[model samples]
Target: MNPLEKVIWILVAYVFGCLNGAYYVGKLYYQQDIRELGSTNAGARNAGRVFSRSAFIVTVIIDAWKVIIPLWIAISFWEMDTIILGCMAIALLLGHLWPVQLGFRGGKGVVVYLATALMLAPIPLVVCGLIILLGYQLHKNLMLIAMIGFSSIPLNLFIFYRNIELTVVFFMMLSVVVIMHRNGD
Candidate 1:
C-alpha cells in the first residue's frame, strides 16, 4: 500500500479502537461511567465487577469485534501488507488504552490484544487460553494469569510464524497491555 493509504488505515484502526466498550456500556446500561465504579477504571474486569453479566458480555463483544472487523477488512478485503497490519495492531491498542474521548484514559487493553492475537494466531491463542485458565485456577490472580496468557503470543510467533517483526510486535503489544492493566488504566 502507499504511504497515505497506510496512514489512513492505521488512523481508521486507531479511531475504531477509541470506541471504549466498557465505558459506553456502563454509561448506557446503568447510567454510570464504568471508570467511576468498582476498580474505577474502564476495562473488562472492572466492567464485569460493576455491571451485569450481559453488559460485560456486550463490552467484550464490542472490544473484540472492533479490532476484528477492521482487521479482517484490511487483510482479507484491503490486502494490507505486514507493516500496515502491524501498524493497525499497534494503533488499535494505543487508541484503546489512551483514547482522546476519555481524556487519554481507557481500558486495560488486554481484550484488544487478545483479539489481535486471535486473529493472527488462533491455535496459539487457544493454547494460551488453556494455560491461562489453568493458571487462573491455580493462582487466582488476574494480572498474573493475563501476563501468562499474553506470553503465548510471542512463543507462537517465534515457533510457528517465525517472523521477527511479528514476534517483536507481539512482545510490544503484550508489554503495553500488561503495563496498562498493572498501572490501573
Candidate 2:
C-alpha cells in the first residue's frame, strides 16, 4: 500500500482508539468523570467502581472492540500488511493512553493490550493470563498483576507471531502503559 493509505489507516485507528468507553459511559450515564474516579483510569476496572458493574462489562467490551474492529477491517477487509498493522496497533495504544478527547489523560491500556494480544496472538495472551494469575496469587495487587502480565506482551508477541514488527508494536504499547501507570493507584 501507499504511504498515504497507511497514514490514513493509522489516523482512523487512532480516532477509534480515542473513543474511551469508560469516560463516555461515565459522563453520559452517571454525570461523572472517570478521570476523577479511582486511579483516574478511563478503563473498565475504574468504570466498574465509578459507574456500575454493567458499565465495567460494557467498557471492557467496547475497549476490546474499539481496537479489534479497526484491526479486523484493516486485515480482513482492507487486506493491509502486517507491518502497517503494527503501526496502527501502536497508534491505537497511543490513542488509548493519551486520548485527544480527554486532554491527553487516559487509561493504563490493559484493555487495549489484552485486545491486541487476543487479536494477534491468542496463545500468548493465555500464557500471559496465567502469569497474571500466578502473580496475583503471590502478591494479590491488581496493578502488580497487570504489570507482570503486560510486561510479557512483547515477548509473547515474539514467541507467538515471530514478527519483529508486532513485537516492536507490543513493546511500544507496553512502554506507554508503564509510563501512563507510573504513579501508584
Candidate 3:
C-alpha cells in the first residue's frame, strides 16, 4: 500500500479505537457514565467500581478485543505489518485512555496496555501480571503494584525471551503504559 493508504488506515484504526466501548456499555446497562463515578475513568476499573464486577469483566473483555481486533484486521486485511500493528496497539491504548469521542479523555488503559503486551509477547505479560498481583497483595496499592510490574519488564525480557527487539518493544510499550498511568495516583 502507499503511504497515503497506510496513514488513512492508521487514522481509521485510531478513530475506531477511541470508541470507548466500556463507557457506552456502562451507560447502556447501568445508566451511568463511568467517568462520572469512582475513579472518573471511562475504562473497566472505574466501571467495576461504580457498577458491577460483571460489568468490569465485560469491559475488560471488550477492551482487549478492541486492540486485538484492530491489529488483526490491519495484519490480515491491510497487510500493514506487525511493527505497524504495534504502533496501532499504542494508538488504541492511547485512544482508550483519551478517547476523542469522550472529550479526548478516558481511562488508565492498564488492562488494554497489558493486553497489547500479551499479544505482542506472552512471557513478559505473564511475568508482569504476576509481579502486579504480588505487589498489590503485599502493598495494597495499585500504583505501587503497577510500578513493580512495570519495573520487572526487563527481568521478564531477560528471563523469558532473549530477543533484543522484543525487549525493546516491551520496554517502550511499558514506558508508554506507565506514562499513561501517571494519573492513577
Candidate 4:
C-alpha cells in the first residue's frame, strides 16, 4: 500500500477499535452500561458480568477481532515496518481506552493488547495468559494478575526473543495499559 493508503488503513483500524460494542450490548440486554456495573469500564469483562453469557461472548468476539482483523489486514496489504505497525497497535489500544463512539469513554484495553501479543509474539502471549490465569486463581485478584502478566511481557521478550525493539514496544504498551487501569488498584 502507498503511504496515504497506509495512513487511511490505520485510521480505519483505530475507528474500528474505538467502537463500543460492549456498551451497546450491555444496554440492549441489561439496560445498563456494563462498565458502570462491573469495573465501570466499557470492556468485555464488564460486559460478561452485567449481561448474559451470550452477550459476553459476543462482546469478546467483537473486541478481540476488532484488534486482530485490522492489523492482519494492514500487514497483508501494506509494506509498513514493525515500527509503523507498532504505532498502529498503540492507536488501537488508545481507541479502546477512549473510544469516540462511547463519548470518549472506553474499556481497560486488555482485549486489544491480547490481540497485539497474539499477532506479534505468540509465545509471550501464551506465557502471559497462563500467568494471568494462574495468578488470578492463586491470589483472586484479577487486576493484580493482569499487571503481573503485562509486566512479564518486557522481561519475556528480552530473555527469549532478545529483541530490543519488541521490548520497547512492550514497555510502551504496558505503560499505557497500566496507566489506564490505575484507578483499579
Candidate 5:
C-alpha cells in the first residue's frame, strides 16, 4: 500500500477502535456512562460489574470486532506488511485507551490488544490463552494470570516467527496495555 493508503487504514482502525463498546452499551441500556460507574472504567469488566453479564459479553464482542473487522479488511484487501500492521495495531490500541469522543478517557485496551494479537499471531495467542485458562483454574487470580499470559507474547512471537521485528511489535503492543493498566485506566 502507498503511504496515503497506510495512513488511511491506520486512521480507520483508530476510528473503529474509538467505538467504545462499554460506553455505548452502558448509555443505551443502563442510561449511564460506563466510565461513571463501578470501577469507573469503560471496559468489559467494569460494564459487567455495573450492568449485567450480557453487557460484558456484548462489550467484548464489540471491542474485539472493532479491531478485527478493520484489520481483517485491510489485510484482505490491501495485504499490508508487518510494519503497517504493527502501526495499525498501535493506533487501534491508542484509540481504545483514549477515544477522542470520550474526553480522551477510554478502556484499558485489553480486548483491543488481545484481538490484535489474535490477528497478528494466532498460534501464540492460542497458546497463551490456554496458559491463561490453566493459570486461572489453578490460582483463580485474574491479574496474575493476565500478567503471565500477556508477558509471554513477545517470547512466543519470537519463538514462532523467528523475527525480531514482529517480536518488537508484540512487545510494543504489550507495553501499551501494561502501561494503561498500570495507570489504572
Candidate 6:
C-alpha cells in the first residue's frame, strides 16, 4: 500500500478501536459510564464485575471484532504487509487505551492486544493459552499467570514467523500492553 493508504487504514483502525464496548454497554443498558463504576475501568472484566456477565461477554465480542474486522479487511482485501498491520494494531491499541472522546481515559488494552494477536498470530496465541494454563496450575496468582502468558507472545511469534519485522512489531505491541498495565491503567 501507498503511504496515504497506510495512514488511512491506520486511522480507520484507531477510529474503530475508539468504539469502546464497555462504555456503550454501560451507557445504553445501565445508563451509566463504565469508567465511573466498579474498578473505574472500561474493560470487559470490570464491566462484568460492575454489571452483568452478559455485559462482559458483549464487551469482549465487541472489542475483539472492533480490531478483528478492520485487520481482516486490511489483510484479506487490501493485502497489507506486516509493517502496515503492525502500525494499524498499534493505532488500534492506542485508541482503545486512550480514546479521544473519553478524555483519554479508557480500557487497559489487554483485550485489544489479544484481539490483535489473534489476527496476527493465532497459533502462538493458542500456545500461550496452554502456557497460561500451566502457569495457573503452578501458581494461582492471576497477575503472574497473565504475565507469563502475555510475555511469551513475542518469543512465540518469533519462533513461529522467524521474521524480525513481524517479531519486532509484536514485541512493540507487547511493550505497549506492559507499559499500559504497569501504569495501573
- Candidate 5 per-residue lDDT over residues 89-113, each given as its tens digit: 9899889988999999899988988
Model 6 TM-score, 2 decimals: 0.95
**Clashes in model 5: which pairs?**
none
RMSD of each: 1.6, 1.8, 2.7, 2.3, 1.4, 1.4
Question: After superposition, which runs of candidate 2 have C-alpha atoms over 4 Å from their true positions?
Answer: 159-161
True-structure lDDT of candidate 6: 0.88
lDDT of 3 by residue, 20-73 (tens): 766988778988777778777687777777888898899888888877877777
Give lDDT tens digits, candidate 1, residues 1-185: 67888899999999999999999998888999887788777878789888888877899999999999999999899888777888899999999988888998888788899999888767778988998899998898867786888898888889887977778888899888777766643
- The residue-by-residue lDDT of candidate 2 on 26-68, one tens digit each, is 9888899999988788888889987789999999998999999
Q: Report clashes for each candidate as comma-separated counts.
A: 0, 0, 0, 1, 0, 0
Query: Would you estimate the TM-scores of all the predictions?
Result: 0.93, 0.90, 0.82, 0.86, 0.95, 0.95
Instruction: Single out the weakest 10-residue window by summed lDDT for candidate 4.
Output: 75-84
Residue 135 displacement (Å), model 6 = 1.3
In model 1, the runs with Cα more than 4 Å from the true position are 183-185
> What lDDT does candidate 5 reach at residue 67?
92
Task: Give the C-alpha miss distance for residue 76 in model 3, angstroms.
Answer: 4.4
After superposition, which runs of candidate 5 have C-alpha atoms over 4 Å from their true positions? 183-185
Superior candidate under TM-score, 1 versus 3: 1
Steric clash pairs (candidate 4):
35-40
How many backbone collisions does model 4 have?
Answer: 1
Cα deviation of 81 in candidate 3 (Å)? 3.4
**Model 1: lDDT to the true structure:** 0.86
lDDT of 1 at 58: 90
Q: What is the clash tally of candidate 6? A: 0
